[model samples]
Target: MTDTASLGLEDRTARVIAGQRVWDELTPLLASRSCTLLAAIAYVGSHGGELIKLERGSSVIVDASVSAVRAGSTDPSVLAEWIGAGVGVYSLEGLHAKMILAESAGGSRPAFLIIGSANLSGSSAARLTESVILTDSRDCLDEARSELLAWKIRAGKPLTLEEVRALGEHYGADRSPGRKRSEQDDTHDAATPSEELPGSTPEASSASRQRPTQLLLVRLGEEFDPPSEVIYHRDRLSSELGCDDADSDSVLFVFRDQSEPEWRLPLSQGAYVIGVDASASGRVTKQTEVAPPGPVVYLYDDDDGGRYCYLHLTESSRDVTWADVTAAFESLGEKPEFDRNYFRKSAVDALLSLWPEY
Candidate 1:
């Protein structure tokens, strides 16, 4: 019951590739009408400038805003080509009944059409629901495109929070289709609310925002699997949870070899990294009405003897509660105390807990 696809189409940027088990018949199409086809498999975005990503395999539970990667058979090259496309390239690698690709992927940025389902896990996915376009008629592809490039140029790699926001200023809202323009969301001006900004607000800034004791990261394998698998994508995801600061904001750097980013840095210095899974989730689900509700983070040990933590978070704003937090902590078998008042310090402790496994 796996699905995938490769596409070959005329130059126009209007078409749909939606179906089950579609990967087998897919193909990659290069640039056309002055556009380059682009694609990749990664959940990327910024929250107050800290780069937060639910990279692969991990399932993040959040309201659809930024994107929920589509499903299908994915080829690395095709995925890469999708990113190179002229306008906006949204690679819906997994998270729905069908895999999808849309937009010119060149000359403009594209807004995502995320969806929801009955179950977020790969195993329960087959029993999940149908495709639901979370945000159609984005009308911001043009703005997002410019901002995307500025973000790429600033980071010199994949998009980061600062870079993502840098584009926001230029590409804030709706982008007229077929006409590339700048979005004003991420832009800075004398009029922007200063209190909630990353630099001014401790709670709002990625640099100051406190997080839970642990974080989670997930990567979709060839396709979303009823059963997920572990993967080691080192080299691309910097060994040190690669991160940098731009425009005074912090974010995780991206890898050129891979179109996706390598890490999701904490919004604040106090955030921590923790790994979650079905086995672990079961314990937490028992304790609360709302689950952790997003991609699960985990501690990963590459064969090379490096240890780093991952996060399963969204690009746009995300909200959680004390009940969910308490449930996550209660699930640990004999966890240690976190160093700080917030979860930031606990995330480090959580990652250390996995030291032996690596």
Candidate 2:
């Protein structure tokens, strides 16, 4: 993201969270300089500029451009916006980078600061692309300033006082100790629509569809090695499961045959929905789940059949029950929502028809 390291400047004096993940190494470095700014985030959709506390920071710049997307090309711009939320996490542009942070400092070369290759989504990667990271630079700082300004004006995405106030309003009004974001508050409406894309209600899209069959396998990539605690806690059904971290791939993987891969389910097996829900807290929970909801699915529905549907658990760690889950499914059945329709984009019918029943 331009010069990614610039976000960590000013001893936390001024911090900006522009859709990217702020890092540790850049922490001490940016704090050293009085330069202030939040980090930038990347994904498959749009770059929404900045998301900061607005307590004591300014001079925020970001490279959230959508021009990166085009036929047969690597577009970083199209992948700059999905970092703040979890809607399209594994899509090519969505999974491009794990929150790229451009330093608050100016003049870092952006061409030298990216992290991955192959258009982010793990797919038909004819090439092995390589991206870099720039902790500090003046050139990058300039580009970021330009980028954010453009998105704010053209795309209408800007980190402003009004938006911050809105976030505060939503989070503050519910500070009633026991109050939670997920707690039923009819007065507080859920922004996500009841239903959005194809086959959204588990009724099967009226037209049989074909979707990019990308399987999230369990193998770890170059990015990270999860901590012991993190692993122990999530090991519930992750051991023998593939696609556990499919989203982890900088690039999304695709297959013509659903059964070709040893671990993935076939096209006619189960329905997949990308829904937005909140817990007791105010967080947009997006996922690709099996059985819609309400059913507490097991790790391996069929051992010999090699069929299994997984509900992606990005943040929630609590054990999910069938009753509540079914209700969720019921809720999902009510409606669907998202900037992009994953099912429609990639024909999901083939996969659903093959889902094995318990």
By lDDT, the best candidate is: 2
TM-score of 1: 0.23
lDDT scores for all predictions?
0.27, 0.28
Model 2 lDDT tens row, 1-358: 4333344432322343222232323234334332243333332211122212111332322222211121112223222232232222122121122223334344552212222221222121111222334433446555655554443343233444333333232222211235332222211111111121122333212111223222211211123244444344235434322224565311112111123333232221122232223332323323323222111112232333332333332222233333343343353453222222222322333322323220
Model 2: how far is 155 from its true place, Å? 6.1
Task: Put down candidate 1 lDDT per residue, 1-358, tens digits, no spaces.
Answer: 1111122222332344344322212221211112221122232212211111122221221111121211111112222322343223232212122212234343333323222221222212222122322222345344434443443343333322333233333222221123222221112211112222233433333322333333432221112211111234322222222223233222331111112233432221112322222232233332222212122123343344333433322222323333444444565643323212222444444433323221
The candidate 1 region of ten consecutive residues with least summed lDDT is 63-72
Native-to-model Cα distance after best TM-score fit, residue 182 in candidate 1, in Å? 40
Candidate 2 CA-lDDT value: 0.28
**For model 2, the run of ten residues with the poorest summed lDDT:** 185-194
